[model samples]
Target chain A: MTPTDLRAAFIADLTAVAPDLDPAAIGDNDHMQDDLGLDSMDFLNLVSALHKRFGLPIPEADYPRLATAALAVAYLDQALAE
Target chain B: MSIFTMPSLGADMEEGKLVEWLVKPGDDVKKGDIVAVVETQKGAIEIEIFEAGQIGALLAEPGQTLPVGAPLARLGVADEAEVTDPVAAPEPAIQASRAAALPAPAPAPAAKPVAAAAPGDAVLASPAARARAAELGIALEAVTGSGPGGAVLLSDIENHVSAGPQPAAQPVAEDRPKGKPGLDMTEMRRAIAAAMSRSKREIPHYYLMHEIDLQSAHDRLTALNADRTPDRRLLMGAFLLHATVKSLAKVPELNGRYDVEPYAPSGQVHCGMAVAMRGGGLIAPAILEAQSKDPDEIMAAMRDLVARTRSGRLRNSEITRGTITISALGENGVDALIGVIYPPQVALVGFGAPRVRPMVHDGTIQPRLAVTVSLAADHRVSDGRRGALFLTEIDRLLQEPAIP
Candidate 1:
C-alpha cells in the first residue's frame, strides 16, 4: 500500500480500538500516546489490529519507531517493500 | 408453572428495576436463557433463567423496581413435542381473552392473584418483551403470549403492535422513578460505600505484598508475539491472570467464599477482575473458570469482559459467582494497591504498574521491569504465610515460558 493508504489504515485501526478518537483530526506526525491519548492497552490493541490487517508482525524492538503516524507509515512502507 | 423471581446478582444488591423483558407469553425457553435486563448499581445485567420450561405469563410490569426473589415471570413445563422440537403452536383461550379485552373498558384487577397465591405458578416472559412493551406503551396484561406455556415474548409485542395501539393505562414515566443518566455517581458511591464498609467491618483481613520480576515474562511475551500480528498478541495482564490462577491451585486455602458456617473453598478459579468505571465507582466481575483457560483465551475473555463492563452490559454470572478477586493498576497507575477483600470472597489480589527497578539478578545489579503483587486474605480462612506462598507461586510462574 502507498504511504497515504498506510496512514489511513492505521487511523482506521486506531479508531476501532478507541471509539472516541476522531480520524480526521489526527496529524501525520502526531505522537500516538502524547497526542492521541492512547494508553498502553489501547496502543497494544491498535498495533494488534494494524498487524492483523497488514499481515505484519510489529516487533517490540521497532515499537519506538512506530510511535507516530508518519514514522509508522515509513517503517511499514520499508517493511512491505522488502 | 413456576414463578421466576428477580435473582440476587450480588450480596450488595437488594433490588433491581426490571429494565426489559426478552420473551413474551407462550414462548419456549430453556435453562441458561437470558430472559431479562435488570438495572442495578453495577449496570444493566442480563439475567438468565435456571429452569428450562415454557413461559406462562409476565407478572412484573416493565419499569417495576422489585426486591430480590420477587416474581418477574412465570415458567411452566414445556410440552413433550415442544421440548424436543419447538414450533409455533396455537394460543390458549386465556391468552386470547386477555388480547380481546381492549383498553379494559374499566381498570382490571391484578392479573395473577391466583398464580401469586401459589409459589408454583410459572410465568414466561423474556426481558426484551417487557422492555419493548414499555417502550411501545402496551400493557403486558393485554398482550396474549404465544410462546410455549403461554409465555410473552418479543414477537407478542410485535403482534400487539400489528393489532394497533391500545389506550395505555399508566403514564410511561409515572410510578417509575424519573429516568436518570446511565451513570449516576451519587447512587454508585452509596453502593460502593455500603459494600466497602461491610467488607471492612465483617472480614478480618491480613495483607501481604511481594515484588515480582516481570523481565523474563516480558521478554517471553515479546518473543511469542514476534511472529504474530497485533491481533494475536497477548498482554502482560493475561500472563498475570494465568499465573494467579495457577498459584491458587498450589494454595487452595486462599480461594472461595467465607460467609457461611464453615468457609467454603471453590475448587475452580473464578477470578474477579476489579475494573474502575470511566464515569465513577468500581466493579469486580469474574471471568469464570480462569484456571481452565489458556493465556490467549484469558486475553480474549478479559478484553470482552472489560468492554462489556465499561459499556454497562455485564451478565449475572460475571457479577455474582466470583470466589477470588484481582485488581490491576496499569502503566499509568500506582506502584501498589492494598485492596479490601470483596465480602463473601476470602481473598483479593492486586497488581501495580510494571516499572524499572534496581534488581540483583545472579548476584549482580541490573534494571528490570518489576511489579508489586499484593494479597488481602480474610484472616478467618487464611494467614499471611499462605498468602506469601501464593505470591511466591505467582512470581515463579511468570519466570517459566510454559504456563498450563
Candidate 2:
C-alpha cells in the first residue's frame, strides 16, 4: 500500500476501536489525546498497534513525533514512502 | 436519554405495575435514590437507581414484565444530556402478563428486617425480585431464580413456601437473660456464609499456628479488666488480636500470599477472628489492617465485628479479604488445635484453652498457659517451613506483647 493508503488505513483502524467515533473529525491535525480520548493506557495501546501493523521501530524516546494524528500520519508517510 | 429501572414492589410480583416515575427521563439521580416501582406477587416495591448515569430511553413501559436484571430503562451516565429514546419499544401488557412466574415476595420484618442496606442484594436474582423480596418481608434464601442470569423470578416466589412472618430480629435483644441467651446466627451467620464463600473460593489459603504461655496473657487481661469498669475490661480475644498484629510485622511472609500463577501476588494480611455463634456454625469476622491497628483499635474493631456478627446485618464487604487469620478456640476451653486452613489465607493460628501444665521456662517448673497453636495451610501455595516460621513469629510476639 502507498504511504497515503497506510495512513488512511491507520485512521480507519482507530475509528473501528470505538465505532461510535466520527471519521471526518479525526483529521491529521487532530491530537490523538483530544480526538480519540486516548488516556495513557490507550496511548500506549495505540503505539503497540502502530508497531504491529507496520514494522516501524518508533522507540519510546522518539514518541514525541506522535504529537497529533497529522504528525503521526506524516511520520509514517515519510518512513513508508522511503 | 436512558430510562432508569423500576424496582419491584413486592416479592410475589412477576412485574411491578409501574406506580409512577419518581423522576422523568430528563431528571438527574444520585447513586441510591428511588426511581420507579414495580408490582410483584406480593405488593408494590420501590426500585433504586444503580448506575449514576442519565436515563437514556424507556424500554419497559408503565407496566412491563422486566425479567429481573433485564434493562427496564437505559442509563447514560457516561454521556450527559444525551437522552436517545428508541423509536420502537417492546410490548407491555402482553409481555408482562405472560411474564414468567417467580418466587413470592418477602419484605424484611421490623425486627430482623431485611438489612435496609443500600440495595446491592446477593447475586443470582433480578433487581425486581431482590426488591420484591426485600419488601414482602421474605429472605432471598427461599427464592429460586430462573432468569437467564439466574435471577430469582416471581414464579420462584409463588413456589416458595413462605417461612411466614419472621419474629422481629433486633441487634440488641431486650431483657437480656443473666447469661447471654445463646444468640442465634441470623445476621452474622449469613455474612459469614457470603464472605467466607467468596474468600475461600477465590483465595488459596495457608495456615500458621503458635503456642504461647497463656498464663501471661490471662494475667495481663485479668489485671487490665480488674482496673477498668466491667464493661470496658479487656477480653482474651482482644489480646490475641493485638499480639497477632505485632507478630505479623516480623514475618511479612505471613502478611500475604504466594500467588505462583503470576496473576496472584502478595496478599494483604487482614486478620480473621473465628467467632462461634451460640447456636451453630463458626464465623471468622475479620479485623481490617490488623497489623497496623493498635491494641485499642484492634479491640474496637473486634468488638464491632463480634457485635455485627451477632446482629447479622453485616455488609458482604466486611466479612472477607483477610490475608491471614488468628482463629482462637480458647473461649470454648479447647486445648491446642489445628484448624482447616481457610483458603487464600496462608495460615490460621488455632489457640486452644490454656491448660495448667508444668513448664520448664528458664529452668523452672512454673504453671504456664499451654495454649496450642495449629497451623493449617494449602501446600500448593506455601512451603511447610515458611508456614512454620510464621507461627514462630506469632509465638514470639505473643510471649512479648509490648504495649504500643
Chain A TM-score vs. truth, each candidate: 0.93, 0.75
Fnat for each predicted structure, in order: 0.49, 0.00
- Among these predicted structures, which one has the highest lDDT? 1
Per-residue lDDT of candidate 1, residues A1-82 (tens digit): 8888988888888777765566888888888876776656677877778778877777777888888889989999998888
Find the candidate with the highest DockQ and give its number.
1
Give candidate 1 misplaced runs (Cα > 4 Å): A1-12, A20-39, A52-56, A65-82, B77-181
Q: Interface RMSD for each candidate model?
A: 4.2, 28.5
> How high is the lDDT of residue B198 in model 2?
56
Compared with the true structure, what per-residue lDDT tens digits does model 1 show for residues B90-197? 234334455554332223223332312233223356678877765664445556689886788999989888977443222333343221234446656778898889
lDDT of 1: 0.76
TM-score of the first chain in candidate 1 relative to the native first chain: 0.93
